[model samples]
Target: MTLLEQLGIKHPFLLAPMAGVSTPELAAEVSNQGGLGSLGLGASTASSAREQILKTQELTDQPFQVNFFCHQPAVLDAQIAQQWIDYLSPQFQKYGATPPEQLNCIYPSFLDNDDFLNVVLETQPKAVSFHFGIPHAHQIQALKAAGILTLVSATNLAEALAIEAAGIDVIIAQGIEAGGHRGIFNETFDSSVRTADLVQLIKKHCQLPIVAAGGIMTGQQAKVLLNLGADALQLGTAFVQCKSSNANIAYRKALFDQPITQITASISGRPARGLINHWHMQIDTPERPQVPAYPYTYDLGKQLHAAAVQHNDHGFGAFWAGSNVAQIRELEAADLINQLVLEMNFA
Candidate 1:
């Protein structure tokens, strides 16, 4: 079967697996509308992930994909975590909450996370995907053995080649314009290639089916990529305001009302694009310590964010978004998919 046929999607539109935003309701709605919906399993626990998959199944019999972060094992340095906590003490004080003495990493270990894998093997979802890095060879083989198609996020030609070589079924060519985290595996994210350029380069070097992502908000942008030979389009920010999404009111409003700016390794120690906020501004200070890698840094940030939210402070949260955030509209997921299809058809 062709990529679209194998995934049981009528249109070439796939919902991007957005951490903290895309919910099972949203995924099911898109899948029910004949588009491929995605569940982001990066931040969720095994039980939560299983529940989410079952919920999506209950909502829609149509096919959908589940995504996880195939992250490297976090090396936690107690001293380094303490330094980060100290750095944010002032902010904690401002919120009338004391920062924890020692920070705790709340993220699950992907290397040891068999929960999602076990869920996949048992439930046998139509498809699965990964960001940060590709899964181990045995894991990939096992998923294939279960007839589950796999997808991988690639930020450059080299990464795209690697995913193709790893025998993944499809490549999500994430451009620099993508929201949330950059998915470059080897090279530092500072060297991220733009989406248009990366798509062309990957198309030149690999024969795998490609799904173009990054800053894709409008039907016109989708058309531009389709014209460039992309087999499909994966979108994130476009669906942020979808009624089925789990984005908080503050987050949705921020995306629609504010102008997005590039913040380098402020919230997370990697180049990420999002709405500029008070926490991001703090990272610009010369006195701030270096941010820890991924889940560790992400965990500390979450603690501070929870404290801030308790006091109704929205500025400290990780309100991740893409460059085309302005185009987001408050509509139901099914309605949004209908609009996108109409736009794509008209274009």
Candidate 2:
């Protein structure tokens, strides 16, 4: 079935989920305008997730996806984690704040999270997506039983094959240039594939429908991937500049004003594509070999970022963006989606 037919939307374009960034208003506005809207539930609690899903449902009857992180629970390295904290001490002192007394795992993988599963079973969004890794059979079955369409990200062909074997409905071919998290199962995987190449690689091995992602910043780029066999396109950075997004002024200005970018593991202890900032520059280096794991290191990163922001410094913020960030424009969510569609000549 066509992506639009399955999702009941006019455009095949999607508002990709961005944790700590995408809001219900942004997702709803895009869905209302005939694009798939999404909420990043990777960092949300079971109760808070339900509230966000319910709120999103209230705004639009269109199908919207709820995304979760299915990564393994972070392994706490007490000594290593402390080293990471100490490394950021100077940055913290610069803003007159100190790191947390201790770092704690802020988020758990959804693979075996009962509360997360129960929330999905109770307030099932039309679709659910997983990142970092695919869930077990039982969880997949539960989501299927709840009538939720399933999607998962694959940075490489190996992950794509696994997603198909696990009975997933769609594969988001997340390329190296994509903003935010890398979604690689192994944090150390050599994932340097581009968006189009990754799409072709997945197509070569899998028949499951593909949603091309990564730094696709324009309709021309989207068209290239769709022509290459992508059923649709999932976009994150493109929506970051929209009026409906939750990006603060600092984040917005940084996306445009800051030109340098990098894939740093320092921000959240995961390799994610974001604009280069003081935090990444000061902390993410060759000498800084390891930090804590995914959600554990985020506690320290956020601490310093929050402290800096309070002192009117924006450089410490996590301003995630794709390499195509230069094309970003200020527009309403619906308007932005509309422009992309018009540029693609689908309007």
What ranges in model 1 sit over 4 Å off? none
Q: What tens digits encode model 1's per-residue C-alpha lDDT throughout 289-324?
A: 777676677766777888899999888877888877
lDDT for 330 (candidate 2)? 78
Supply every candidate's count of residue pairs whose N, Cα or C atoms clash at under 3 angstroms.
Answer: 0, 0
Cα TM-score per model: 0.95, 0.97
Best by lDDT: 2
Question: What lDDT does the true structure give each of the candidates?
Answer: 0.82, 0.86
lDDT (Cα) of model 1: 0.82
Which runs of model 2 end up more than 4 angstroms from their true locations? none
State the lDDT of candidate 2 residue by residue for 6-81, as single tens digits. 7778998988899889899988998999999999988998888999999999999998999999888766888988
